[model samples]
Target: MWTTLFLSYSPIPEYEYVENSIPTFVAIGGFPFIAFHYPSPPMGSDVVSQSMWPLFYLNEFFWLIIGTILTKLLPQKIKNYSQIRLFCIVMTLIISLSGLGYLVLRFD
Candidate 1:
């Protein structure tokens, strides 16, 4: 999923870290880290998972705070109109395709 998100993003040079790393980390948390909240990640995972749950949400809260600050301070984040349009187009296409693919997989 992160790979697909990256394909949609396709960051330009100046804002690469802001574009790539943030979403990647978010995706990692959304998927792998989230598994810890489920039944069990491993045989002995209960203790570890319980201990880590609060920290996960705390990390996400901090990330949101940082992102809010960055957006306020970095108004020129996108650099140009073309890059913005490209990002929108690519993300729209990827999301649409992914939704259709998911529906197909689910029903078929």
Candidate 2:
């Protein structure tokens, strides 16, 4: 599952901390560090960490619904402009909000 996510997110830039060193993928209690050479990350890991799960869930939920309806209900030749627009808008908002949540949680 996470591998799919990583592949899907391949367009993102490769940061040295996330790339070179052993990135802590999941942390139980303390702040989870992604950068290299870090055991327990600084305080406040839960802030962005928690937000990401919900955003990912929401995005999946919306995408599943949209994708299912498009595949099942739509005709082969016709395109649903409204649904496509809606999906795109929601996805963009989801990405933007998640990024914002990450910054706020990680830094502030």
Candidate 3:
């Protein structure tokens, strides 16, 4: 949720056209997935071409709902299994490390 909020507010330049073309602002939500582009109008132009990616928001909402449902429905025995806990921890570490690596490479 915090990531989504931050990404929505802080868009990074992802692509640029020719010298005269407008630059595209891209924001990635939901961690490493779901990116949307916001195109701004060129200077001194009244016409604005902007769009919102509903799926970007929808995807997060969908996951939230699904996660809530699964948490409520799944048995405690399965949720509390040692192997499951270990797998979740490992996966979280891998994802975090990969994301950190990407950020370091990108910003460096």
Please report the candidate that would top TM-score against the real structure: 3
Q: What range of 10 consecutive residues in model 2 has the weakest lDDT sum?
A: 29-38
* Candidate 3 wrongly placed segments (more than 4 Å): 1-69, 75-80
Per-residue lDDT of model 2, residues 1-108, tens digit only: 222233343222236346556545323211121221112345444444454565556555665676798889767674788898899799888876775564454433
Taken over the whole model, the C-alpha lDDT of each candidate is 0.43, 0.46, 0.50
lDDT of 3 at 95: 68
Give one digit per residue, the lDDT tens place, for model 3 in 1-108: 334534554465544345665554333334434443333423323322233336545656776787799899976666558888899799878866775454333223
Off by over 4 Å in 2: 1-78
What clash count goes with each model? Answer: 0, 0, 0
Q: How do all the candidates rank in terms of TM-score, highest first?
A: 3, 1, 2
TM-score, structure 2 vs. true: 0.30
TM-score of 1: 0.30
* Model 1 lDDT per residue over 13-91, tens place: 4443474333221112232233222221122222334454565466456656776898689767565889889997999
What TM-score do all the candidates reach, one by one?
A: 0.30, 0.30, 0.37
Q: Which scores higher on TM-score, 2 or 3? A: 3
For this target, which candidate reaches the highest lDDT against the unseen true structure? 3
